[model samples]
Target: MSISPLKETIPKLDPPNNTSLHPPPSPSTHRTLRRLKSAHVLGSSVSQPSLISQQHKQSLNRNFSPTRKVTNPPPGAHTRTRSNSDANVMSPALSSPISRRPQMKRASPVEGSTLDRLIRDGPTEGDLERGLESMRLKILDQGVKSDGDGMSSLRIYVWLVLLNAPVLETDEYLSLIHRGASPAYSKIRNDTFRTLATDPLFRRRVSEASLIRLLNAVAWKLHDAKGERSEVQMRLTNTANIYGSPELQHATPAKGRSRATTLTNDGSDAGKSEPGTYVQGMNVLAAPFLYAARSEAEAFIAFHQFITTECPGYVRGAMDGVHKGLALVDKVLAIVDPKLSLYLIGKGMNAELYAFPSVLTLCACTPPLPEVLRLWDFLFAYGAHLNILCIVAQLVILRNSILNSPSPTKILRSFPPLQADIVKEVTLTLVKKIPDDIYAEIVIHAK
Candidate 1:
C-alpha cells in the first residue's frame, strides 16, 4: 500500500465544477504574470506554444515600444489593448512628461444663454417678471452671464432693469446738458480723450464729444445734489444769530461780507469743491454706459444712477469706499489664497497699492470692454459690492504666477485684462466663505 515518493508528491484535483477554487487575477497581477511569462518564453530554449501566443508577444513588445509607454488597465480589467484614437484622447496630464495644474473653467455658456433668454425676445410685463425671477435665481444659483459682444442690447437692458433705472425724461437730461458742464468740466474733458483709446470697439463706436457730454452730465448731477444738500442745510441753520449777534450788528461792508460768508458756509470764494465731484476714473465708468446705450442721455442716466446711488463713496473726495474696497480685497484674498495674500503683503502690495483703478472703475479699469460689461452684469445682478470679492478672485486667478515671481508687487502694477466670466465664477464661490459681518461691510462700503 506504500506509494513511491514521485507518486505521493502529485497534487489532487477538486471534483468537477465550472469555476476554479482560486480568485481571478487583478489587472496589475495579470500584467505581472504576463511579464514573467514573456521573460520565461524569451529565455527558454524549448518553445511552449500555449505559453507564448502571437498576440501576447505583440503586447509585450508594444509595452517596450520607443514611441509611448502603454497605459495600464483598471484594477479588474481583462484587456490591455488601446487603439491609437484612445491613446490620442488620453488627457495631457497623463500623456505629457510634465502635468499642468487644472485651470478654473469659465462657467459654461449655457448659463449665459439662460440669462440671455431675458432679452432674446423683449419680455412683456409677465414675461419680464418671470425673466427677472429666472435671472435672479440663476445669478444667485450660479452668477449672471454675458458674452464677448460688450454692447449687446441685452446687456444694457439688463443693467437698466437691475439698477432699477427709471425711464428718464428726455427733458431732464437735455436740461443738464444745456445748463453747461459743472466746474469739473475741464477735468472731465481731460480724461475723456484717452478713455478706451486703444479699444477698437470703443474707439470706432463712441466719439470723444459723446463721452465728454455723458461725463459732464454726471458732474452736473453731482453739482445739483450738492446744491440741494447745501440749500437744505442753510434752511436748517438758526438765522437768529444773524439778526441779534453784535458782530453782524456793527459790521462794516467788509465785515458784513465776511460775516455773511461765514454764515452761509458755502466757502465758494476759497474754491472748495463738494464731495462726489467728478474724479478721473469716472470717465472709464461712463465708457460702459455710453458703449451699451443707444443714446448719450441713456448713458448719462445709467452712469448718474450708478455712481450717485451705487457707489457714491468711490467718487467722493477721499474715495473712501474705494480705499475700503482695497482693504477688503486684501482681507478677502487672504481668506481664499493666504499664500498669495501674504506674499503680496510682504512685498508691500496690499490692494491700495494696486487695485485703486479697479475699485473705482468697477474693473472697467482693465480693458476688452466686453468683459467689463460681463462683470458688471454679475455685479448688478448680485451686488456691486461683490466687486471686492471679484478683485480677490483676480488675485486668486493670478495666484500661481504671483507666488512664483521675484517681484510680485511690480508684477501687479498692471494686472491682466479681465477674464470676467472666470472671475465671476471664482467670486461667487468666494462669497460663501466670507464671514457675514465682513460681507455686510462689503455691501455698505460702496454705498
Candidate 2:
C-alpha cells in the first residue's frame, strides 16, 4: 500500500461560548486558539466540553495554590522552614549563577483559553485524569507556546501533569544535592560540558553546572535504588539456596556475579558488560527538563521521574531498552514504508547507525531546541514509545532525498532541523499502518 500526502489545512472546531469563566482572548491569542481548533494534533477531531463547572474550576485553582509548605528535611539536615514560594530559591552549593540566563515568565490565565485556564486553575480531583487527557489534547492541538528566549511559560507544569510527576519538595531536592558528588560525578562532569554545546539557545538557557548537578543527583538516586535491589536479590538467592534442591542450588550464580549483565533474548552482550550508575547521552536527555523547568528542583523532579519511570531501560545497566528501541525503529520503518526501508537496507543504512542518538535522547539530539520541546510535549502526553514511530516519520519525510541519493548515509548523517508538526502528522499516519503486534512491541519497548 502507498501512503498519500496529508492536507496542509486542518479543520478547526468552534471555540466554546463560555467567555465569562475565561478571560477574553486578544487578537493574537484568538489566532492561536483558532489554530489549536484545527485537528492537526493527533489527526482527529476532539470534542471538548463547552464549559467547565464553577466548582471544577475552583478545584483546579485550589490544586495548584502556591501556599503549600515544604516537607521536613531528613535528620542532620537544615531545620529552617520553607514554602512553595521558595521553590525557585536554590542552595549556593547546588548551582552557579549563569550571567546569560533569562528571567522566567510564568504563564498567565489571560494568555489563551484552554491551556491558560488549566495552568491558572488546575483540573478537579475527580476529573484529574480526564483533565490531564484534556491538557494533552490541547497540547497536541496547540503546542506549548514559548517566548523568543526559547522559554515556555507553562510547558514544565504541563509536562508535570502529563508525566503524573508529583510536586517534589525543594528540601528533598536540596538534600540530594547536599549528598555532594555522586559516584558518577566525574563521568557526569565529562559529559555535561559537551551536551548541546553547539546549540546557542541551549547554552543561553541552560548551564553546564546545572546539568552536572541534575545528572549527578539522578545518579545518586539510581545508585541507591540499585543497592536496594541487589540486597533484595541477595536475600532471595539465599532463601532459594537454603530451601531448594541440590540442582537448584548449583544453578544459582555466585553472589558477586553482576545482575546487570544478565542476557536477554536479543543477541546483544547485555550480560557481558558491567552496568554503571551513569551512561553516555544522559546529558542530552536531561537538557530539556532543565531548559523548561523554572527551578533546579523542579527540573530534577521531572527529569528523575522521567528516567526512573518513562524510560528506565534506556538508562539501565547495558541500555538494552535503547537497543530494543533502535531495532524497533528498523522494524517499524520496514513495516510502514517498505520501499524506503528496502532502499536504506540496500545501502546498509539501518537505524542502529543513524538513529541511536534520537532513540537514546528522545530526539533531543536533533537541533532547533524549540521544536524538540514541541515534539516532547506530544511524547510526554501520549507515550514515549511513539517516539520510535516519530523517528520513522523523520525518515519518511526525507524519503525522496534518501531514495535518490547514491550516498544516503550522508543525508542520514544528521536529521534536518526538526519540523515538529510535519513529523507529528507523519507519525500519526504511520501509526495506523503499523500492525497491532508490532505496535504493542513499540508501546513497551522502552520499559
Candidate 3:
C-alpha cells in the first residue's frame, strides 16, 4: 500500500492565469428549490396524486445520478492541480484536510447489498418528526446484522449525506455530527453512523458500481425523509402555532473568527485568483458548487448577524443570486395557496434555527443522497417557496436537537477537518423524512 507523493498529487494545472475562463457567481443558484423540512409532510400543493409518480418520472429524467453522470469532468470544469492553482489563489482558510489525506491507492470495490425488507413501506399517520424517530427505531430494530452488508453500507452513505448537509456554518462539516456538537444525534445517531461510514474495509469490499448504486439508493431513501416517509411535518399543524415574525433561535453568533473569503482574490495582477479559475486555480474553489456554496455560507453568516445585529438589507441584496435561486420555489408555491407567505416560518423560531443556507444548497454541491432526496421531496411538494424556509427549518431542527450541544464553537472548530462518511450520514438523519402536513406560523402571527 503506497501513498501518492505529497504536495504534487492533486489534479495538475498550467496557465499563468485562467480568470477569463471563470463563470459568474450563482447563475443557476436560483434555478431550483429544495424542500428539506418536509419533503412529504406540510408539503402543500402537490397536485395530490401527481406528486411522486410525476416527480419520480422527472427525477429519473433530469436528476443527474452522480454514480452515472460523473463519468467525465463537466465541460470546462477545472482539471488543474493544487500547486498550479495555488500560485494564483490564496490557500483555503482550512488546513490540508485529513479527510482528503493521501490514501493507499484507490480502494477496491465493496460488496453489493441485498435490500432489507425490514424498513416499513413509509411514514405512518404520525408526523415526519415522529416518523424519523420511528424510522430510526426501525433501523435500530434491524439489529445491525439484519440488513446484509450492502444495505447497511448504503444506509451509512445516506446518513453521511444528511448530517454533513451544508445547512449551517460550514466551519467544520463533519464535526457537527460527531463528538457532541448537537447532543440530539451526537449521543446516539453519530456513533451508529460513524461505524458505518468509517467502514472502509467494507466499502472497498463492495464493487465500485454497486457502491455507487447503493449511495444513489440511499439518497433516494432519505430524500423523502421529511415528506410522506418523513418523521415530522414541515409547518405547524395548528393555526395558533403560526407566528408572524421570524424570531431568533441561536441568534447568538457561533464562536469563531469570521473569515470571509471574498469572491475575487485580491490584487490587480491576480493570475489564477480570478473567480472563474477559483475551482481549478484554487483548492478552495475545487467543486463546481462552491460558487453558490460560498454565497450560501456568507448568506447564513449574514442572516445570523441580521437576527442579532439587524444589519441593513445589504444581506438581502447580497442574497440576490440565491434569492432567485429560492424564488423559483415561491413561484411554484403560489399555485398551492396564494395566502401562504412562501416563507414557511414556524412560530417555533424561538424554538429553533431552520435549515441554514448551507443546508439549503445541500452542502453547496456535495449534497449526499439524503439531503438531495429530502430536498427533492420538498421541491416536489411546494416548488420553490420551500427552499430557504426548508434551509431555515433544517437549521432550526439542528438547533432544537442540539439544545444540549456541549459547545457549538468546539464542534464548529472541530470541523473543516475530516471528511469521514459518518459525519455525512449524521447530516441525513437531521434532514430526515419531510412532513406530510404543516400549519403556518404567519397566520398565527396575525391572530
Among all candidates shown, the one with the greatest TM-score:
2
Task: Go through the candidates in order and give the clash count of each.
Answer: 0, 2, 94
Model 2, residue pairs in steric clash: 60-122, 261-271
Off by over 4 Å in 3: 1-360, 363-368, 410-447
Residue pairs with backbone overlap in model 1: none
Give a tens-digit lDDT track for model 2, residues 1-447.
Answer: 000012122323223232233222122221111222221121233254211111112221236322232344568853322212221211134222221111111222222447756655654553443444456556666666665444665677667655656545555554565577788887888888889988998887666666777787788877887777667665755665568634454454653233312312122343233245789988999999888775666677778777776787888768989999999999998888899999989988888899999999999999899889989987886677779989999999999999899999998889999988888878767766777678767767766
User: What are the per-residue Cα lDDT tens digits for candidate 1 across 1-447?
Assistant: 000000011112122222222222222312211232221122233234322132232342111011123446568754533211111111122221111211122222333445545444333343333344455445444443333354343455456656655445444554565566578877877788899888887877776766776677677777888889777656644463545555567778788767766765764522232466788788888888877765455567667767876787888777778888888888888887888888888887778889988888888878778778767866776567778888888888888899899888766888798887678767767866777677767777875
Q: Estimate each model's TM-score.
A: 0.65, 0.71, 0.20
Sorted on TM-score, highest at the top, how do the candidates line up? Answer: 2, 1, 3
For model 2, the stretches where C-alpha displacement exceeds 4 angstroms are 1-113, 241-276
Q: How many backbone clashes does candidate 1 have?
A: 0
Instruction: List residue ranges in candidate 1 displaced over 4 A.
Output: 1-131, 138-148, 239-274
lDDT of 3 by residue, 207-295 (tens): 22222221222222223331342123223222212442222222332321111111112322221211110011111111112111222
1 or 2, greater by lDDT: 2
The model with the greatest lDDT is: 2
